[model samples]
Target: MDANDLRDLGWTSEGPDYRGSRFHVRYVAHIATHRQGGVANLVTDECRDTRYAERMLQEWARDALKHSGLSQAELARRLTAHLHRAIDRAAVNKMTLGKRAIAGDEMIAIEEITGFPAPLENADGLIKVPMLDSLVSAGNLSPREPVKPEDVDRYVAASGLPPGDWIALSVEGDSMDLVSPPGSVIFINRADTRLVEGGFYVVAIEGDHGTTYKRYRASPEHFAPYSTNRDHGPVIIDDAFRVVGRVYRTMLDIGPHASRRGK
Candidate 1:
């Protein structure tokens, strides 16, 4: 795929400070474990001196596998069972880069196996420096101070998403405590709106400050947004209401610092 052609397929550049830096998104095939080699390969950058690559790989695997319907326990079981057949980081890394270098008919065979074309032309990922202070614009979080999107990025990165693909936000209340705790750092995908019911999401609604987070409850009459803390109650649906996006992932105990990338 041509780099310029990627935009047609929803690919774009991303970086830690989308507001301040210039970053490019590189697209690739989403891989899963294979019996031939059980590890899903996703990146090709030479490991070199970057010990952090392992952590990045682990996190990406979690997100990719989870999205593929493999539970954490199930993933562990599979890895343990396929340890011998499992592809280690070195081999997987090579595979990712090789996949990125292929061309023509070869790309088709690779795509069939990975569900993504080889020499992947353009980026399929997106990144933006989310406004941290808006972490809890919801009524519940109204009392807290804002955090930085870059700091949230690091926290979310440790949670297993590419830094360019994650955004941090503060928890407004306990409405999502079954999963998200108050003040926890939330890593959200602005494009993921089809969140599973009963799952958590970050919503925005008309508020004194602007938009805020709410537990998403979809129904015929309205997109019922709720709060975990009973004191907050549920905000019913209306014609003007909309779901900004779903909370596919999140993190906690993020260190107090801004993301330092590019410079």
Candidate 2:
């Protein structure tokens, strides 16, 4: 099971709570035993082996340096002054290059200095989801297809989403308006394809009509618009309509000209 699965079962990184309100002795024991086993399993898991971990460390260190906009010598000096840890440029290079393993204290110091998680701890609370190349229309129908890995623009890390299959889609129109404006990115939980009352969803119709985003309601099925201008009226849902996925979250693009017309 993954970290999320363990969390669902009440396992915490703060360690087992034998005396806590929700705690059972057996549950605590199980957590301890399983956590150890899980660590071992993760170490052996594909893409998380020793080599990958070293590469991840190197990449994170380099990324941290780049993001900090500080030279190695300057960072080393700052680390020594602020953290009160006498780590020199040579030591930083050696650690970043994977020539030396970063100690726990050093990791903590680096995290404090850079305001970024250490490589070994980076994946603790993040889920990586693919950003699809195809745009989902907010006003008109757009062609939809199964997303391949090669078609992914990038992998985006998200948190607090329900555990399920998810895909990212770029908004193409202002139909979703304030909720998901054009140029915004929406995260859809593909597993939640069932029609639900009073929820925004990506939907498709039969034939070559393609897909569009709409606020859906069941019982008297229809695709309702939330736009103020009301350019499009409510579309009556029929047997031809298919609920593709639910829009769980939206990342708005608040660029300089985002408020302008046809943006």
Candidate 3:
């Protein structure tokens, strides 16, 4: 793709944070393996050299445009038709400037229009699991806006997780720290909400309050916090409730932090 036009789909001042975000741990893992041409450590310093990654994209777009025999404006027109989005030559020019990011869908459209091989292809055949861009409280029930099932904060590669209604949520408190600590991103299968005895589940007693991450104890059928911090106790949910989902996997904070990019 000749770049630009549609918009700066993934541009972020903090980093390459954008819609259909490709700046996750799993995203880096796939990059590492491809860059090394073999298995590589996915967590070594996050493997996110934004400058290098952008440079590669810049070069790829330039070469693809040159080889396609399509002018930048023509390529933008093709992209607009393929994506059914308003794309102009200026936006494509911005894509070549290394000052923005491209979302997965945007990149896919470019690949099709330019006939260039996919730079970020699924060479590892990893599954794309959409993640929540925000955090859910694990302590008190902090109220939050409703999130539609289709809102994807980012995409993470899941080699182990089977395809389903799996959504990822980050935690904000220490209440469920034993299993999923604060700052951890927990993956929950929305389709699998049937509470199993002693299994972990996210619950909400009120529509206005944010969901609580807890372990269900069948002894008295109460939602119990799993933290060593006893200040957070078990909640005997009396009101009619909803099980948001059951968390099956968690990615713990494994390194020094950076501010996450999302709305």
Best candidate according to lDDT: 2
**Winner by TM-score between candidate 3 and candidate 2:** 2
Tens-digit lDDT string for candidate 2 (1-263)? 44566668876667554444555646645775675766534534755565776778778888788877778898789777644347799988987798986654455556657777665444444465677766433213223555565667654556678887788787766777768777777898777877778898888765544577789867577887667557867777654866668899988646454443124
The 10-residue segment of model 2 with minimum total lDDT is 135-144
Task: Give the CA lDDT, 0 to 100, for residue 86 in model 1.
Answer: 36
RMSD of each: 21.0, 13.7, 19.7
Cα lDDT, all candidates: 0.41, 0.68, 0.65
TM-score of each: 0.37, 0.51, 0.49
How many residue pairs clash per model? Answer: 9, 0, 6
- lDDT per residue (tens digit) for residues 38-62 in model 1: 3334233334323344344334443
Off by over 4 Å in 2: 1-59, 63-121, 135-146, 256-263
- The pairs that clash in candidate 3 are 3-92, 4-91, 4-92, 5-88, 5-91, 5-92
Instruction: Looking at model 1, report the run of 10 residues with the lowest lDDT sum.
Output: 254-263
lDDT of 1 at 71: 47
> How many steric clashes does model 2 contain?
0
- lDDT, residue 205, candidate 2: 66
